[model samples]
Target: MNIKKHAVITTVIFALNAPVWAGEASFIAELASTTLPQQAPVVASISTSNTYFMTSAPFSANSSAAITHQPQPDPAITLPQLIEKDWWGALAEITVVLVIGELLYKTGEESMKEDFDYEIEGNTGRYFVDRIVTTESWKLDDNEVGMNWGHAYAGALYHQAFRNYNFNYYESMLGNFLTSGIWEVFAEYKEVVSINDQIVTTFGGSVLGESFFQLSEMLDTKEGWVPATFAGVFNPSKTLRGWFSDDTANRFDRQQSTDQFDIYTGALYSTKDTADISTTTMLLGVKASIDSVQGQYDALSATPSLVELDMELGISAEGIEDWQLSSSLFLGGYTQEVKPTTGSRESWGHNWFIGPSMGIEYSSLGQEDEEDFFAAINVIGLSAGGEWQNADFNISVRGDIFGDFSMVKPFASKDYQASGGQFWGTKSVLWEGGYAYGLGHTAKLTLKQATENCY
Candidate 1:
């Protein structure tokens, strides 16, 4: 109906017609081989007909008899089998991302070096060795907010490559981390190993990649060309393969399961207060959650888990902005229900969960901004929560303990600083109890302290 759909259909048709073309060639060759035996008879019959039709006519018999043979049906050709999970394709995708990223970085560096009249060292081997082998202290790099965010997105591309090949979630996450590490260690030989970039690329990218994956899956399940096109755009790796390879024909009718995942897009505005300055930030975010309960619920099934992924892009009127991502796989213990003469018996349930959460954040974009353009990663950390819900009331409490390893260039400092320490304890509680119209109140407290020279 539309250009995109038409394009997709055309590509599929072309792929399927490849075998048809080959078969047609074979059929023509077979007809030529069989024509030799019948050639004499055909010629004799044509001569007899000509003689019988023109008995007394003086006809110049220079005309040749044309043989009209009906085309034979083409035989079927066995198309090349499509591998469901192509490891080589995944590796090729990773290579492309790394190569292109490095090339872009080198180009930008060269342009800047020429403009600033600074000579950049060309000894890539030495640079790599110095950064990889030497025990150098962590120092903040000069990369700005855009660069850090781009690195994270690059990592997401790597994740998507593996995901496009049907890799599992954990495998895709591992690919993201490994690809980022490879880029940091080898691809950008001119730059030092960036601690912040690694954190942002690996963890933040995982959040972004997983969120995009879910959203794309959701879009793909919709029954419209617009949604399908958006789905392809959301997952560029899949789009590329679909357009360029026969994989599209193989997966044309593939369906995605939508019962286990929920995707939502929304906007929020919030204000943060620190000392004497208050900053209001507006964000556009997408959140996706996968509930394991959708498949099957077994009493002995090792603690049911829920995976949540969130990605946000925020900006302030004062020109401060950043990209933030977070993902957590929460594993819950046994569920218990209490039917205490409730108005709605179906709403009573109690659940407790505890799991590790990891994420990365990069902030501060303006050139003249006093804030630091830093990356912070919270590694696998513990988060525990309990919720009790009923028809008329709901109560929940949550606590998180995590640590952040950060590379930051403070506003007042001339150089970058590296810091890492435990976040100690953070807690929150929510209480809401109403039958017809629900009203709720929340309270939170956080205590965190970090020390310098943490490697």
Candidate 2:
């Protein structure tokens, strides 16, 4: 059966079986209450009369207390009361992703095997069963490097579509996995299932998807056209839904919140020295953060939601250039307050995050070479950081840790090397602090090491 039919049957079975399990406790409670002694009716009548007498009295100091003492009925048990059953939105999102994948495949965006032996026909059921039960060995395909990266981006878009329909973070993640799985198993039935595509699309997509979601949320709060336009681009599912249905727009309206937004642009200079050669590169960057503004009593209590973006363009003395981008979105955090005998109060907070981070480095010395070695790393993973802030001075110190699945490629002279396999590692560190006048600076150190052999 197709995914839709499977989902419908599963939901029906659950609906039929749910009442039996949920009604057991309720039935026993009602049975015990029904079997009480015959004098219970007389006692209940007397209690009700007393309650009525108290409530019917003229206004008095004790009158309010009488209402407080009244008995309330036990709440009824129902299917919705026992479980949250909002899977239709999720199912619709999955269907949309599947349909889009089929469209892309049919439009020549993807290639199929020459024999076309896996075509859906009288053997549709057997084909699905075979795909599910069979496991293929890991191997590399001939798709371009850009196509590989596009898979992660597609995954992120799929995730955003699910979120647009009000799915939670974990549910949205499963939607991405399902979308990728559908594309791998059935959309390209003639091609071999790719292990790399699965990992990058699901995990890396999560990092990018969450960041995009936060950015879209942040943009939605602004009243200007520029922000709204970008928000729609980042979250197309919501934009499209709004065009077709008013209820979808209303639902998203309820999700928007009042949050602070700030944007800053600056320049950075870094000097590198190796042996007798020294090189300097100039970077122009823009940084934006939402809901990260500090308050007077922020040291005591602060808003924990934050979405941050930093994008930079690096130019060497010789004019060779590269682009770098890093983004992070935090769902929630834990905070603690510290008080010292002679110093101001300090607040420390730690937050968990998922997002995309990418960096590129040039190999050759600058100022003369037309071509340089290109090394780039892309990863998506769980990240965490702790910050100590003193709202009195508006200063804070932070340290971050990253554990991720990474793809590293080294290229030169208009040719790029293919990524062999997925690698796992801790990639970078950032330490930053700022003063009242924004006179402070940030310092970051990155470490890259190979942990496993690849193709």
Clashes of 1: 0
TM-scores of all predicted structures: 0.53, 0.54
Off by over 4 Å in 1: 1-85, 111-140, 222-234, 242-287, 293-343, 362-375, 391-394, 407-455
Clash pairs, model 2 backbone = none
Clashes of each: 0, 0
lDDT, candidate 1, 1-455, per-residue tens: 12243542342343244335323433333344344444321111111111111111011122222221222222111111211347998889888877887788778776434223112377766755666555352223445445655766776787787766655444566677667756766655445565556656666676556556655655656677765775676688777666777644332111211222333444455433542444456666655555432112110111113456555666677543655555544333222222222344344444444444445555543334335355555544566666555445656676765555544544433222224322133110001100010112212233332222221
Candidate 1 has an lDDT of 0.46
Tell me, by lDDT, which candidate is best: 1
Q: Roughly what TM-score does model 2 have, to 2 decimal places?
A: 0.54
lDDT of 2 by residue, 115-144 (tens): 143456677888777765555322223344
